[model samples]
Target chain A: MGTPLPRDPIADAQRNWERHGWGDVAAPMAAITAIMRTQQILLARIETVLKPFGLTFARYELLALLSFARSGALPMNKASALLQVHPTSVTNAVDRLEKAGLVARSPHPTDGRTTLIELTAEGRTLAKKATAALNSEVFGNSGFGADDVDHLIRVLGTFRRDAGDFTEE
Target chain B: MGTPLPRDPIADAQRNWERHGWGDVAAPMAAITAIMRTQQILLARIETVLKPFGLTFARYELLALLSFARSGALPMNKASALLQVHPTSVTNAVDRLEKAGLVARSPHPTDGRTTLIELTAEGRTLAKKATAALNSEVFGNSGFGADDVDHLIRVLGTFRRDAGDFTEE
Candidate 1:
């Protein structure tokens, strides 16, 4: 990482927004921008942990999701929905994983039009190892304090729900 | 966006973690995953606003940064540092902006070894328009509530500070 800046760049950007007569939206702008930066920080950390396992965060998420499935498989569209990623992204991840012998695509038994993505034995093993590493190296020591972690989950949960990510039951 | 899921996927993932004997790390895992999902949601909104201007968030950030510079220019390295992105990413943004006639690069006047990136008039104008659109469509009505906005700013500020993004005075 570069040396810590003398000041928060987002704060400077917020000041610039205010100076430009955007006082009304400056805080939201800074908050949104902070989320972008924080995602970058967290993704970098997560990716580092997953790298040795030959996974990007996207691919790892797919593997982890499958690993949690009772049948160790899901229809492509269902996986896409659960992952909140585009179908094309799921397709691409499946392609990579299949090439790496971590997953396979098979015709859905009950639906000819659907394809099921099944985690291979190797995929399950890798997912377990990767999760263990992430649990220990990243999540177990996530940078946010305990209260901040709870706060983030609640706040971002609200934001996500507002964005139509899910409906609260 | 896809149809709203029946439940929060991150919450489901946290439960899965807890069931797997990762109870201690489950909350942090969910928090981080929520952040990842939140960033995706916000970025999609931001990108839609930026799309008509032929700008991505990265390029918009560079244009906005240079527009705020007193000279409408900054050394390329300094721009990267201030933006907290890698120098290669700054270079890539510069390449696209230059091709679009939005920014130009020149040898630094006093520092022969440094390259300076300056916003062209077009870049400045586009940045203004893009910022106005984002302010109106996204920032002004950010999915976050007003109180949540302030909370995000403070909470994320602490996280960023701890991550070495800045040294407060």
Candidate 2:
């Protein structure tokens, strides 16, 4: 790398907060800021790995979602809901994926007004290869050991639960 | 809210991965995806709290940074570096903050080619008030107990450190 990425800025900010007599707020600020920066770093890394496959993380997610569908296809509306994204985003992803010859759109078999997204043979093959690449390069070695990974999920899960992401038993 | 935000989609996706015989990747994917979604949720919450102050989270961050400066001013390049963002983003943030009367720009006192960003009196006042609002409304109630917050920071810190966010001690 030309220049190494600098040390965490939030750490410096936290010190600054303490100096300014705002130590009470520093912990939460540092936590949130780190989460945001970590997201950026992870996305950048994933995108880099997907670049050679002509996929951004978003596109890769769409392909992977399609690949996971039991019928190898899903209604656009269902895709939108399942992906937890807006309808326009799903539509846009499909448009680009279709242009890339990785997926196709057709009228839903049982619903006249519904559109269905189905993967092409090329799309299926690409999805598998991309998955393998991501597994080895990004997912498999995200720098967190298995215990750390489990802890992260549990910690973040608490926030998600409180935000109404799901009701706890 | 008309309907509470639905359960975290990533959790559902993780389950789908297991059902599809990709359980091996589910743990890492869940951890990463939950982190990504949590970032979005936190940003949205922060933005909402900052809305009444006529600030987005990015603008609020700039104000807070200036407020924390020992000299109450910083060079633009320094702001970019400390903020861990591109120079163009610093320029953009300063431009918006200036337009909002929260900050002012001037030539550096001793450096001919450097520009300095200083918080206006109004900016200082707003920064404090905004900090208070965020502290009580958003940051203070981020859904993580103190222990969980500490745990999240430690776990995410590991990833950040390994990703070259900072050098190890």
Candidate 3:
């Protein structure tokens, strides 16, 4: 804890240079690299638009997921896993979602460290509106059909599948 | 900065909540919802593995782009535009890359605000190896293939285009 991060150039550089080789660094950085950069640019562009709806992307996601969920809900752990974050983060997100009245948390009834989250009535109404709005923005009027989407999901799933966690080979 | 950020409750919660909802928070944060979330998670994982390399995703990206360029170089502003980062951020990234001996800079013949970047021999050599390794990790016999990748990219592009970024849509 003394050092927030390593400082030994001689010692740490080798360790830091672990697997992210020159080859990977040289590639399209987009095709195989992370999507955060592209998204960050877009996110900033979209913020002003979302302002009128009183929704942040996260809240919208919570509402969207809950609305799409089979039971209109999910356990805390499931949500966390689905969202790809640590359990603690899910706990915090759910807590906020609860406060916003977009979602509610209940005892797991199964696991102690787990909680169940479901959308509130208000949450559902807002989520639907948001989803529709989101859908429109993503596709525009070109009207690329469901088949295109299915194919895309399939391919991307592969991209993600092969990529794994981005750390392990 | 007038304010580190605005006192927007909705925006704040969205930013925090996104740590979970978007599926991964491993990348740097940005206001764009989909792009940022995707970037954060993928970058997070890649960077985690890359920590041993003493490189941030930023530095890695610089290497990758230069390696991919036919001339083994690009202008600072071109790089910034391509990466969706500010010109200053591009300058900072280049400084780090130059120090690492992975890339070099030359004054632009055309633009004063621009600097040309080229990968070093060592940097070029290293980048090739890293990309192969990363390709293996992402699609590495993952039971997903080119068809899958094609489908996925199309879908994601569609989604991003349709969604118009995370913040507004």
* Best-matching candidate per TM-score: 1
Local accuracy of candidate 1 as per-residue lDDT tens digits, B1-169: 5799889999999999999999999999999999888999999999999999999999999999999999878999999999999999999999999999999999998898999999988989999999999999999989788888998999899889988999984
The reply for model 3, stretches above 4 Å from the true place, is A1-51, A68-74, A88-92, A95-112, A115-122, A139-143, A156-169, B1-51, B56-58, B68-73, B84-92, B95-101, B104-110, B118-122, B135-143, B147-169
Candidate 3 lDDT at B113 equals 71
Please report the TM-score between candidate 2 and the true structure.
0.89
- Candidate topping DockQ: 1
Ranking by DockQ: 1, 2, 3
TM-score of chain A of each: 0.96, 0.90, 0.66
Q: Which segments of model 2 are wrong by more than 4 Å?
A: A1-7, A18-22, A109-113, B1-8, B15-24
Say which docking band candidate 2 falls in. Answer: medium
The reply for model 1, stretches above 4 Å from the true place, is: none
Considering chain A alone, report the TM-score of candidate 2 relative to the true chain A: 0.90
Task: Please write out the lDDT profile of model 1 over residues A1-169, one tens digit for every residue.
Answer: 7899999999999999999899999999999999999999999999999999999999999999999999878999999999999999999999999999999999999899999999999999999999999999999988788998998899899889988989984
